[model samples]
Target: MARTKIIAGNWKMNKTVAEATSLVEELKKELATFEAAAVVLCPPFTALVSVARLLQSAPRIQLGAQNLHPAPSGAFTGEISAAMLREAGCRFVIVGHSERRRYFGETDAFLREKLLAAVAAGLRPIFCVGEELPDRESGRWPAHLRSQLQGALSGLSVDALSQIVLAYEPVWAIGTGRNATPEQAEEAHALLRKELEALHGATVASKMPIQYGGSVTPRNAGELLAQPDVDGLLVGGASLDAGSFTSIVFAVQ
Candidate 1:
C-alpha cells in the first residue's frame, strides 16, 4: 500500500486561541483545493478546544497536540494526558520533539512511556526520532536515531506499531533556518525505513509513513516530497502562517 502524504503543522508555543481560530478558518478555505494529503494543525493546549470546535465540521484538516503525558491522569502538574488530548478532538500527538528533549529533559524511557500511552488512548503518536548536529558530525546519526527508535518503540506489537507516524527531524536544522537538502532528507528517510523494516517487517514498514520535519517550507516542499522514501513532512515555523502552510499543502497535493 502506498503511504498517504501527511503535511502537519507544528505551531509550537505560538498562537493564541483567537490566532489559532483564524489560522484554522484560513486553512479550511485553502485546503479545499488540496484534498490529496492529510493536513494536521497542532496549536498550543490553550487553543485546542477552540480550534477543535472551529474544525468540527471540517474533517479534512485534523487537530493534533504538541505533547502529552504518559499517564492517563496524574498529579503531574503542567502536563496533559493522552485521554485529555483525545477529548479535545486531537487525532494525533507529537512525542520526543528535540525541543522537549533539549529543554525539558525528556529521555528515551519517558518517550517510550508516552508513545505507549498515546497508542493506548487511541491517538496516533508521531514519534520524533532525530540526531543532534554534533552526533551527525561524529558519524553517529544513524546509531543515535536507531537507538532512539528501538527504545521509544520497545514493546509495541506490530499492530500497535502500524499506527505510528515516524518523523526524521534533524536537530540542527529545526528552527535554525538551515533546511536539509532533498538528497539529505531522502538518505535519512531511507535509512529510517530500513530500520523500521528490521523491527516491523517490510509489509508493515512499507505502509508506515516517514515524515521529514526540519525547516520545511513551500518553496522546497515539492522537491522534498518527490523523494521516493520521503512520505511526508512535519512542518514547523512555516506552518504557523496559513498562507505559507497552505502553499506547502498544495505543493504536496
Candidate 2:
C-alpha cells in the first residue's frame, strides 16, 4: 500500500488566534484547488481552541499540536496533555521536536512516554528524529538515528507503529536558513525506512510515511518531495505564510 502524503506546518510559538484564523482562512481558499495530499496546520497552544473552532467545517485541512506531555494529567505546570489537544480538535501531535530536545532536555525515554500517550489518546504521532551536524560530519548519523528510533519506539506494536509519521529533520538545517540537499535528505529518509524495516517488518515499514523537515520551502519542495523515499514534508518557515505554504503544497504533485 502506498503511504499518503502529509504536508504539516509547525507554527512553533508564532501566530495569535486572529493571525491563525486569517492564515487558516487563506489556506482553506488556496487548498481547495489541490486534493491529492493531506494538509495539517499546527498552531501554538494559545490558538488551538480558536483555530479548531474556525476550521470546524473544513474537511481536507486538519489541526495538530506542537507538543504534548507524557502523562495524561499531573502537576506538570507548563505542559499540555494529548487529551487536551484532542479536546481542542487536534488529530495529530508532534513529539520530540529538535527544539524541545535541545531546550527542554527531552530525552528518548521522555519522548517514548509521550508517543505512547499520544497513541493511547487516538492521536497520530509525528515523531521527529534527526542527527545534529557534528554527529553527521563525524559519520555517527546512523548510530544516532538508530538509537533514537529504537529507544523511542521500542514497545509499540505493529499497529501502533503504523500510526506514526516519522520526520527526518537535520538539527543544523532547522531555522538556520539552510536546507538539506535533495541527495542528503533522500539518503536520510531511505536510511530511516531501512531502520524501520529492521525493527518492524517490511509490511509495516512499507506502509509507514517518512517526511523531510528543516527549512523546506517552495523553491525546494518539488525536488525534495519527488524523492522515492520522501512521502511529504514537515514545513517550518515557509508554512507560516499561506501563499508560500500553498505553493509548496502544489509543488508536491
Number of clashing pairs per prediction, in order: 0, 0
Give candidate 2's error at residue 105 in angstroms: 0.5
Clashing pairs in 1: none
Query: Cα deviation of 150 in candidate 2 (Å)?
Result: 0.6
lDDT digits (tens) for residues 161-251 of candidate 1: 9889999999999999898899989999999888888977898779889999999988999999999888889999999888899888888
Q: What is the lDDT of residue 159 in candidate 1?
A: 74
Instruction: Tally clashing residue pairs in candidate 1.
Output: 0
List candidate 2 segments past 4 Å from native: none
Predicted structure 1: lDDT: 0.90
TM-score computed on alpha carbons, candidate 1: 0.97
